[model samples]
Structures are given as structure tokens and as C-alpha cells.
Target chain A: GPKVLQIPSHQIIDMGQMVTLNCDPVSNHLYFYWYKQILGQQMEFLVNFYNGKVMEKSKLFKDQFSVERPDGSYFTLKIQPTALEDSAVYFCASSLEAGGSDYTFGSGTRLLVI
Target chain B: GDKVKQSPSALSLQEGTNSALRCNFSIAATTVQWFLQNPRGSLINLFYLVPGTKENGRLKSAFDSKESYSTLHIRDAQLEDSGTYFCAAPSNSAGNKLTFGIGTRVLVRP
Candidate 1:
């Protein structure tokens, strides 16, 4: 099972601060996705990136949220001026193709905004 | 307006027993994926399907495109199986983003 590695299992930041979550998707995988799950709630889609550009994003992906993979580096999600409702576990996933095959997910980073 | 609906929001199962969870989609879902979130909060991929069936050990899954639904069956359920199970489908036309169901929490009892 190929693994998608997420850095900093847990992060605590102030409500109006910016925080970046890093994800190391499986090597050779083309599609990358980010999902957010609040405590005891459904995991919602944030955004999906491919070819160094955003493919599609959900309404949940706010204007303040952005994702990028600089120079083929780690795919990262940055939330600026985080809100209280932004506190949740962020899961990173990757797929080798768009055919619903070889989708691997990271352990997730639990972000807490105080 | 819920695109994906999962039934049995919660269930309690006895170890070694069998049970099935289901997902009915209102949107056009060509592919379905099942994931299990353990107590440690790790989302583990269980099955991925495209209008077909797949089996792995005690877990079996099937997706029906014409019916717009998917199913996950657990045989010989174990205590470790106690967790939240989620079924997700890629956006009908986008094929990139996933729309997940609310999830079903299963508790395996000894």
C-alpha cells in the first residue's frame, strides 16, 4: 500500500493566523486531493490538484484557502486567518489515475484553531 | 439536496457476525470508494470500484451505476472493525473531487 505522508500530526494555531499543512503524495501519482473532517462529521472535499493546477474545488474550499505544489514538491494547503470552524482533521489523498484506482490517503493532520 | 446518502447512521454488531452497509447516490456516480476511519483517526482505504464488485479478506464491496448505489459487506466482523465507515464518489462530471456520505459508525461488541 503506497502511503501519502502528512506532516505534523497535530497543529495548534491562533484563530487569525496562517497555517500550512504539508502532504507528500505517493511518488508517480498524478492526482492529489484534500479533505476536511470535523469531529464526528462527514469528511468533505476541499480541493483537488493536478498538472500543477487546480482541477476542481468544492464550495467548502473558501476564498482564504489555497493549495499548491511548488516545483513538484509537497502538495500543501495553506489557510490564512483561520476561523474557529476551520478546526478539523485534514486528510490528503492521491490517485494514480482518474479511473478510481490506487487511491492512497495520509494519516491526516488534526488542526486546532483557538 | 444530499448527493450521497448512507443508511444506518450507527450500528452495533457482535464479533464474528456479518453486516452490510449501503450508500445511495442522488447524483451520477461512476466510481465509489470505501474507507474506514479507525479509533486512532486514521482513514484506511478499504475498497475502490467502478460499477463492479471487489473482495478483500473479510470485506466485500459492490457498486451499481445503473442503480446509483454501492454496498460494503463485512464478514466475521472483529472488534478492530469498530469504527466509522465512509463511502465516497467522485463528482459526476468533474471526476476529481469526491462527495462523501455522512458515514456509518459501527461498534463491534465482544
Candidate 2:
């Protein structure tokens, strides 16, 4: 099975600081997505990226958040001036096709903002 | 209201028993997917369905687009089956994004 790997499985940062979560999606996958899950809540879609551009984003994707996959490298999500409410586990998923395709998800990166 | 709703928020099953988890959708879902999140927090894809059924090992899944629902059945449950099961469907017609259910927690006791 294909795998999506996330770096720094656990992270702790101060509020107002910047943090970048890295995801290495399946090599052949073209569509990428980011989801957020609070400690005891359901996973919520944050954004989806394709062709180096953001295709869609939910309200949860705040202005302080951004995503980019530089030159076919790791897809990264950056949050600047983080807030305490931003504490959650982030999961990355990738699929070969846009619709009706099976997605492979990473184990997730747990971020904690103090 | 939840776009993807799961019933029986939690379940306790004895090893070798059978159990079923269900998801009712408020949105028009053309396809459905099932995943299991282990205690270690790793999510493993279980099935991808399209208005039909699929079986692998002791697990079976079915999706009914007309009825707007999906079901996952675990047969002869094992202790390793203890985890959280989630069902998700595409948020748009393009099937580019997904909306997930709150998930059903299952504990298989020996």
C-alpha cells in the first residue's frame, strides 16, 4: 500500500510563533489534502491542493495558514502567529485522482500551541 | 445536522462475534470510504465503495447511493479490531474533498 509520511509526529510551539508541518505524500499521487482533528472531535477538511494551487478551503483554514509543495518536494503547511485554538492533530492525504478515488492518509502530526 | 452521521457512537463486542457500523448521509454522496484509526492514532483505509458491496477477509462494506447510506460489518471480531471506525464521502460533485463522520468506537473484548 502507498503511504503518506508526516514529519515531527509531535510538536510544541509558543503562541504567535510560526510552525511548518511536513508531509511526504505518495510519490505518484497528484491531489493532496489537509485535515484537522481536535482532541475529541471529528476530522475536518482544511484545504485541498492540486497543480501547485489551492483548489478549495474551508472556514477552518484561517488567514494565518498556508500550504505549498515547492518544486515537487514535500507538501508543507505553515501557520504563522499561531493561536492556542490551533492545537490539534493534522492529517495529510493524497490520491491519484480527484474524485471517487481512494486516499492514503499519514499518521498525522500533533501540534500543540501554548 | 451532520452531513455524515454515524450511529451507535460506541460498541463493545466479544471476540468471535459480529458487529455492524452504519453511516447516514445528509449530502448526496456518490462514493464512500471506510477507515480505522488504531489506538496508536494511525488511520488505515479499509474500503472504498460505490453503490455496492465489497468484502475482504472478515470485513464487508456496502454503499447505497439512492438511500444515502453506507454500512461496515465485521465478522468474527478480533481483539485487534478495537479502534475507531470512520466513514467519509466527497463534499462536492467533483469528489475532490471529503466530509467525515464523527466515527464509531469499537472495543472487541476477549
Candidate 3:
């Protein structure tokens, strides 16, 4: 069974600070994705990355948000100048291929901005 | 328009009862996956279907690509099955992007 692991299960940060969320995808997975869920809302897709580049991103992925797969070690999502609205549960998911594949998700990292 | 919509926002069942949860997709979904989010907030994959039915333990799920809908049936529900269930659909044109339903909260009481 494949599993995705996310670090810093819970994070608290002040507004305007920079926060980085790390994800260690399955070793054999080729596609990684980030999803966000506000309290009481459905999960929304943020972005997807593959081949060390961003494949697609939703409108919720703002300019302050960035993702990278540096050194093929960990896929990370960084948010600079975080806003209060950014407070939500961030989930990291990975799949073997681009489409029609079941994705494995981590337990998620809860981010709080004050 | 919501790409995915789930029915019965919340449900409560007595132990040993049976229930069904559903998801309707507005998009041309090529694949469907169901997940259960437990009280600990851990999302566990239940079923992944492509226009077919799959059964595991007391859970059964079916997806119909032509109708763009999916159903999850729980036979003889237990307290451990109490959680939020979500169905996600990836559109044929979206390229690996999944749109999730708002989720159905189920509470099973003894």
C-alpha cells in the first residue's frame, strides 16, 4: 500500500509570516497534488506538480503560494505573507500517474493564522 | 455550478441499520473515488470505481459514468462506520484534478 506523509501536523503562524508545508509522496508516485479545505467546506484543489514542474493550478493558488520538488526529496508548498483566510487544513496527495488513478492522501496539516 | 454534489448532508442510524450515500456529478467524470474521514480527520480510501461496483466488508459502492452518479451502501452499520463520507470525481478533461463533494456526515448509535 502506498502512503503520503505530511510534516508538522499542526502549525500556528502570525499573519504576514511565511509558512512552508512539506510532503513526502510515495516513492514510486509520479504526480503530487495539494488540496485545501476550509472548515465546513469541501476540499478544493490547489495545485498539482510533476516532473519537477507545476502541471496545473486552481484560482485558489494565489501569488503568495508556490510549490517545488527540490532534489526529488520532498514536495513542498510555501506561502509567503500568509493571510488569515489561509487558515485551513492542507492535504498532500500523490498518485502513480496523471489521471484515472487513486490518490493516497496524508493525514493533513492544519494551519492556523492569527 | 457545483461539479460534485452529495445527498443527505447528515444522517443518523441505529446500529445494524442499512443506509446509502450518494454523489452526483455535473461534469463528465471519468473516474470516481470514495473516502471516509474519521473523527481523527484521517481520510481513508474506501473505493475507487470506473462505472462498476465494488464491495468490501460491509461497504458497497457503485459508479455509473453514463449517469454521472455514484452510490455507497452500508449494510448493517456499526458505530465505527460513523464519519464523514466524501466522493470525488475527476473529470475526463481535467487531467488528474478531482472535485470533491461537500460530504455526508453519518452517525451510528447503539
Q: Please report the candidate that would top TM-score against the real structure.
A: 2
Per-residue lDDT value at A68 in model 2: 100
Clashing pairs in 2: none
Q: Estimate each model's TM-score.
A: 0.96, 0.98, 0.97
Identify the runs in model 1 with alpha carbons over 4 angstroms from their true place: none
RMSD of each: 1.2, 0.7, 1.0
Q: How well is candidate 3 docked (DockQ)?
A: 0.75
Candidate 2 ranges with C-alpha deviation above 4 Å = none
lDDT of each: 0.92, 0.95, 0.92
Per-residue lDDT over A1-114 for candidate 1, one digit per residue giving the tens place of the 0 to 100 score:
689999989999999999999999999999999999999899898888989999888889999999999998999999998999999999999988864568888999999999
- Rank the candidate models, highest lDDT first: 2, 3, 1
Query: Model 1, range B54-99, lDDT digits (tens) per residue?
Result: 9999999999999999999999999999999999888747576788
TM-score leaderboard ranking:
2, 3, 1
**What is the RMSD of candidate 3?**
1.0
B1-110, model 3: which lDDT tens digit per residue? 88999998999999999999999999888789999999888889999888899999999999999988999999999999999999998853745888899999999999
- Per-residue CA lDDT of model 2 for A15-75, tens digit only, reads 9999999999999999999999998678999999999999999999999999999999999
Output the number of the lDDT-best candidate.
2
lDDT, candidate 3, residue B97?
Answer: 87
